[model samples]
Target: MWALRRAYNPLKRRGFCIGTSRACGAKSELGSCHLDEKASVGEAAQVIADRSLSLKRFYSTTGDSSKFFMGRRSFSSQAGAKSSGEVDDDLEDGFSELESPASAEAILESNAEDENEDELISEPEPSEGDDEDAAVEEPQNELELSDTETDVTEKRSPRKGVPSALFKAIVAAPGLSVHNVLDKWVEEGNDLTRAEISLAMLNLRKRRMYGRALQLSEWLESTKRLDFVERDYASRLDLIAKIRGLHTAEKYIEKIPKSLRGEVIYRTLLANCVSINNVKKAEEVFNKMKDLEFSITPFACNQLLLLYKRFDKKKIADVLLLMEKENVKPSLFTYRILIDTKGQSNDITGMDQIVETMKAEGIEPDINTQAVLAKHYVAGGLKEKAEAVLKEMEGGNLNGNRWACQALLPLYAGLGKADEVGRVWKVCESNPRFDECMAAIEAWGKLNKIEAAEAVFDRMLKTAKKLSSKHYSALLKVYINHKMLVKGKDLVKRMADSGCKIGPLTWDALVKLYVEAGELEKADSILQKAVQQSQMRPMFCSYMVIMDQYTNRGDIHNSEKMFHRMRQAGYMSRLRPFQSLIQAYINAKAPAYGIRERMKADNVFPNKALAGQLAQVDAFRRTAVSDLLD
Candidate 1:
């Protein structure tokens, strides 16, 4: 019996139990068993008794012994017994004798079984449809997670209202090749929305990737998938001209279907022509719009008016009459243009009439209108009226407006109203931008108030967080005008020490100062060094400076050298350089005729002014040679 007990303990630890009496088909008579079956029956009874003792111990450890007995019948029934009725009665009888606690190991085993059974009872099985859905969604969820991770890793999140994916794809495409990437996106079942396309265009434009922007616009237009409105077509045309030049834009307009070339498209093209100063193309488009009886907009007329106002002030009236004939109402811009034209021509009465007409038309004068009125009045010597206009601007919420204050200061300076200039400076001094300070400095410089200019400059230096080359240049100009060479030179040195990049304008100002002070050699040397170190290409102003100084000194050798340098530095097509060189050649009695041939070779035909100047120089040379021989 002791050996059987030892063997039974190991089997119980291993979760092996003896078969039930039901399995042997012998219920209700365990004590009356035959001797041959006695050993097996006794073992079975001992195993059942041990399991019951384990359950009681488990329940005592968990503090639920009564609940354990209550659940015992159900647990036994669920274990797939051979006979439910016999198994229930036997389990109840065994639990009834389980008052004594069992071993810790047996209790733990019974508790584990109870938890597993509870789990089986609590959890429901998933259906086949649910399994299929999970399988389908698994890859999709993984793909989304990977995309999110990639976005985080690449740091290509959306910015400025542009989508992350769209912006990243556009940036990844090579120069002007965004259309190819966009096509790939379409192939991948992703389509760009119109808003996205517009935003991409705007982003590319801001980045100055005009070629790629134009390509994208062209691609979008060619697809015919988008319902492009007038503004879209106009923006596209404007970009086309900006990227591919005006001629290409004209050709593109010609290629557009006649039916689609409505007034809006023609107006856009006309505006482009005006912007590029293609007067012929502008006129052609304007005539076409008129011939088609398309209502010409005031903006288009304003452009034409601006173009004509440059050379023919009389033609401005004709454009106005044309606008009146076409029943095209003049916008505020049109009135401003007319006011500017009349002011330039000294037609003060006409300007006043236009102002009254605008007022009659219920068009209030904006800040721009006030600025134009003041500028023209100043130009026409109406200082009192200009001051009134400026005062009106101040009353109209332009008080402390830096730009308005800047503009007014210069006008007051021009009018010799130093007190008014000081008052305007006070108004802007509270929070002066660099431009405003520079403008104030310039105003004081214009008034020849060197001390006032220096004071403003000093204040700017002390208050400004960041100073650009222009600010330095403005102060340098004041020093130059006053012939303060030592101060100007010291400022230049300080600019260099401070690592401020010397712009062309600053270099020009310094060179002009030196040249004006008769330090020709130093001026030339400084200009040469600046040209070498400057990241910008040498401008015509630099070459013109040296050429003018050398020619005036009759140093024809150096003058010609400077001319060749200008050409080598790619400043062709400027008539002033050629004129300077020709004058220097003629003055030196060298071969002056070769300049004309060179101009022809460069495809720059001498204008009437240049030709007449050349002829006069030739005749003067002849007179000088004759006087020398006599």
Candidate 2:
């Protein structure tokens, strides 16, 4: 029983009760080394009884207790091993009685059974010091026993193995990507192995958690686990997405595998940057490409040239000089971008340089570029210099966009050069896009050449496009300026018939014309209709029109009533209407009008002011006829 107890303890620690005590001793160290201090006493006792019974039965039946290692540790040896097999049966019965989750009782019961079943069954041929060996084993077993047992297995079983616990926690991460989990664990100082982390990262990447994969890859790089190939590809992808300028793009060119740094990649990235207005980044990429001995596209060079000229012409010139020194060939488009930007910035100095560069390149500056340059010249009041560019464009094979004609037409119109205007108009007529004809018409009107202006208007109608309010307004104002009332009314009617929105200016013009021509009824009808149409009228203009209509018709009472209404509506001041009231009073000459006459006249048309002085002079002249009458 004691021997059985010795073998059973190790078996309980290993989670298996396989054989007799001595037989179990061969694998005892492998099993016992893993046991902790928290194993359960009941489990330990059960293990003890089971191992002891198995050991005793096998040893007694085989008559070889050497393999079992029981020796004197059990009562079979101490009481008498009269028959080893019979003693084994007794030990088995003892084990069944003591194996009720208690080790000590099972040992004692096995001892009593051995003593009771002392009859010999089978005799073993002793080839060794069997009695002494048994005695030594018993004392050792007794010394190893403790007074109190602990259920260490119960307390420690939950946390038994490190590998199993770690795996459980990792797998139970609620479908979390393994790469993310590894990164979190590493970040948290969880001591997860690198191989484990790498495996997790790979798993996550395979699941298409690309963002998470990139994070882990970055972490791997930060941690210095990143290999050459991954680092190269990742850097290239990132650079293509973010870096813009030629200088920056050039810098990345070297990092790219030799096979990938072709014109397509280079030009594509450069063009994208230019379009998106990322010029600085594009410049950096371009510079980087230079170090790699790669050639840039003409378009890229042109875009860069334009960017430089637009933002800082002087700086760009310096860059161009530097590039020239480096033997970089500038394309014609490069000169064109230069011309365009210089013209846009009104940089005359840059424009001269652009012309010089175009000459050096043996390339004719396109008409659009030349037109912009000419327009700048015109703005500076240098018309002759602008004409020179236009003249040069005529002789050269300039691609004729509407730009030059548009610029030149206005310039000629401003100078009142009708011949030049006609010439520009002809060019404008050739191209459908140019609005030069409209501009020429406006200029003629501005110069007070209403006849020529009307001629231009008739030409615009031939274009078959609907007449715009702007065109109508221009012509309307021209007619009004000439006091051509009939023509002005016709223009307004034409504007309305064409569904053109009449503005306040147009309405004011028409109203003033009618009132000036003494067409009071016509002016009044127009005003009422305008007001009903909800057309916003200038308050002063409306009041003036109404007053003009009443005054022209000699309707003093109606005029006075309108005056009061205007004042009440906050549109007219009492002071403004005082003169008209005084005039009306003087004209009527009714009862009590004599004493109030001079006073009323002075109040509105004071002799100290223009209206007053005029009224006082008229009064003096009229009264002068009645000299000495009083």
> What is each predicted model's overall lDDT from 0 to 1?
0.54, 0.43
lDDT (tens digit, per residue) of candidate 1 on 1-630: 112212212234322222322222132122121112333343334333322211221112122223322212211111111111111111110111111111111111112111110100111111111111111101010101011222233223355334346655877777657778888988998767864665565555434345666677778888875776654665677667655656777777776666666766776666555543344456657666655667656656776765554433323433553455446677666666666656655668767877777777788776556767777777778888988987887775556455567557666776788898888888787777555677688789879988888888888778855455546777887787788899899988887786665655566667777987888889888878877886444434555766777887767889988888877765554455666777676667665655666776764544334565567555335666788898
Best prediction by lDDT? 1
Candidate 1: residue 49 lDDT (0-100): 32
C-alpha TM-scores of all predictions: 0.51, 0.29
Output the TM-score of candidate 1.
0.51
| Superposed Cα RMSD, model 1 | 45.6
User: How much is 477 displaced in model 2, in angstroms?
Assistant: 18
| Cα error of candidate 2 at position 175, Å | 42
